[model samples]
Target: MNRRVSELGERGLIRRLREKFPSLHSIGDDCAVLPGIRCPVVTTDSFFEGTHFHRWWAPPQILGRRLLEAALSDIAAMGATAKWFFTALSVDPGIGVNWIEGFYQGLTEREDVILAGGETVRGERLGITLTVIGEGEDRDTILRRSSLHPGDNLWITGLLGRALDAPAKLEKAGGLSGKDLKPRSGFLSSAELEQLRAFLQPRAELELGIKLRKAGIRCAIDISDGLFSEASHLSLESSVDTVLEIDETLFFDSVKDNPLAASAAGEDYVLLFGAPVGLEFSSVGCSKIGRAETGNGEMTIFLDGERVSINAKGYDHLGVRK
Candidate 1:
């Protein structure tokens, strides 16, 4: 599967893939043209087996839903509403027709998103990539790492660490059984299914972010790499320093205070945004944990006013293993 290929063969492969999927419109070779939207944004991403996901851990439908959510998070970060998506899928002989159909079923459930078209091919391993096109108003377009300013209050939506830290409760006692991790109503009697639902399928914060932008926010990013790494990115890009005061009370029962763990673990996909101090947003549950400063050129997170060290770094795609 990893054999070296001639340059001509690679070009031929790309040409054939393009031939299978017809282009509906031509804006540029790199960017998709959106005639209806005055302000349009195009984003492209890919997910691969044993990296973006573990096939043994997630069902095909759930895997598909995760793929869609990851893309939508990017749109939401820009305060844009998703319009449509184009998908390209390649699979090894191990995949079946039923699995592909189930994948599409989950993808179709998202609001305001339709699969305009896609391509398919037979390969040595399973993989899928999607390019999502979305639209936002001129005022509502947000940016990541950039656009931050001095004295802006940093806020993150939703609680962190619950979904990933909590163990997948088993239905049976046998350790070897694959059925142990399957969704069960009674496995964790004390835990609410709705809470786990967010981790499993993170809905984009499009409306909330757009509303925040309309309410006068200028800088923002989605918390895919958790709070620690993203906060540093914001500080570095905006040419400012930040003091992150994490709200310890918002954590789930299983929450722990390993800073590196919090920062490096991806897939939370919540919005982390900056607003001017003294703004009131009663609609969304946000906690003001940090402030941008200009004196120091580093991120210093304070827990009850003291600096601490942690081991978590952001997710590296190659680092994730089956």
Candidate 2:
């Protein structure tokens, strides 16, 4: 037996039902890739003040890029190419038009993504929602979390905790003045600045997703939540057992000391996928982190072959922590 799964007994129960009914595995992941002349995919993502983000955390331009890429990450997970987007903004009276223009500028930076339309309304708090539409590059090989199978090798693009500690690092400085990137500490170290930018300016790895799909990988999930959280979801959705190996080198230098905790920090926005065994992708910047196995939908971490339990905290919109 593998290690005990943390806080997911409900998934275990559901797994039995899925196992009994083998045909129930075709659910979906991330963006909804509906059948059509190019397999149209669509996703909706929303962010609001004091919950998803803070105005002081970054400049409007940076925030716009960050949130857009976050939404586009869903498209990448399904190996789809973004074609268009619609934005809806809810803002307070205190916000200025210049800030809105800057946000729009960052949002429309890419020529590939056209702004179909948007709606703006005045509200007490600032909020932005985006509906991104895309088409699958190849309909047959579109990635989905439910496509993982037992004995599949788990591979991850880039480091697992690239920006894991960035939240505390940025919040330590008390953030900016809701205007500019001026630090209260008078100055920030170059390393800190780089880490802050890592969190704020992440890009959806569209090319990587397409490459993986072409390479015969058909299962993947974006790391918007913690690594373990998403990994658990992949296992549950696929109705298989997963064993994750935590290599110290898999984490960023800042969080390597406590890789278990770091893997739960989220905001990496990288791809974690399942591939066939004997396939090496290190040249393309991917590392095998684990494997799926035959069992109830459960996940475990084995360090040096000994199972360890991890309380991987996923981001929640409300006060609940899952």
Candidate 3:
């Protein structure tokens, strides 16, 4: 009998796989470590055409850039400097060579990030897998989600729920359902353009993470799977409860009306971290939205002094039904 991966979920499946091929270093951490290196942090992320994104939503260049940023976000969460990247791209033969060139252009635009190596293959669908390698300034200073402690304040960098607004804006503009999925110049409103930019070209908060690490803040995770889901990971790993007091103003004005947007919006790629009270981050826009407490792993969200129910879960590859 074949076992369904959905029964195990993403994390559970990873755990089972780890047991089969145990790592000499850490297994559950965000990045895999190699002993000989200078505290190297490595992670891989995949972007699929139909599953993770749609071509109509963004141009090839933007899509390529977003994919790289998503992989780099993991390195940022570990408080490491991204050094090199390798990509494996599988795309349909129908795709234009110009489109592929555009993708490479976007991926290499970042001067600091070097594309050391990659592989290309023809496939039925478009898929991009990026492996990012980074190194911490000091091995002891690298942040880990499991290191969060009780009484530590949870801080989030940048606005949340901005990505959630993109599809809605595109739908309103008839771009989503239209025959031409490519965005036409001057067709989108200013607000819609802003939403598109946020969704398509989200940046990794690498500098912020490095700053936090240098300031002696240790525990952190990038918000790739929404604040609630990622916070739950920290809570479970640290064996603590996280109480998030949602500030309406913390969200973009476009999504502030939706109370659940900030908590449930995925792909924001912002850094969510825990730090000591009164630790100042100069010129960095961050807010103390919650705190970790000693208790069973639980995540509570509050808005306007009332607990609001949110039904939307984070993006889970095995859990989400097609």
For lDDT, the strongest prediction is 2
How well is each residue in 202-295 modelled by candidate 1, as lDDT tens digits?
Answer: 7778778778777878788887776777887788778888887765654443444543454456677787888888885545787677888775
lDDT of each: 0.65, 0.75, 0.74
**Which candidate model has the greater TM-score, 1 or 3?**
3
Candidate 1: clashing pairs of residues = 260-312, 264-313
Shift of residue 84 alpha carbon in model 1, Å = 1.4
Q: What local lDDT score does residue 136 receive in model 1, on the 0 to 100 scale?
A: 78
Which portions of model 3 show Cα errors greater than 4 Å? Answer: 1-36, 174-189, 309-322
Cα lDDT of model 3 by residue, 215-274, tens digit = 898999999998888999999998889888887876766677774765677888999999
Backbone clashes counted, model 3: 0
Q: Lowest summed-lDDT stretch of 10 residues in model 1?
A: 171-180
Question: What's the lDDT for residue 1 in model 1?
Answer: 33
TM-score of 2: 0.80
Q: What are the C-alpha RMSDs, in order, of all predicted structures?
A: 8.3, 15.0, 11.8
Model 1 CA deviation exceeding 4 Å by range: 1-35, 139-141, 162-196, 257-260, 310-322
What alpha-carbon RMSD in Å does predicted model 1 have with respect to the real structure?
Answer: 8.3
Per-candidate TM vs. native?
Answer: 0.76, 0.80, 0.80
Per-residue lDDT, model 3, residue 51, is 83
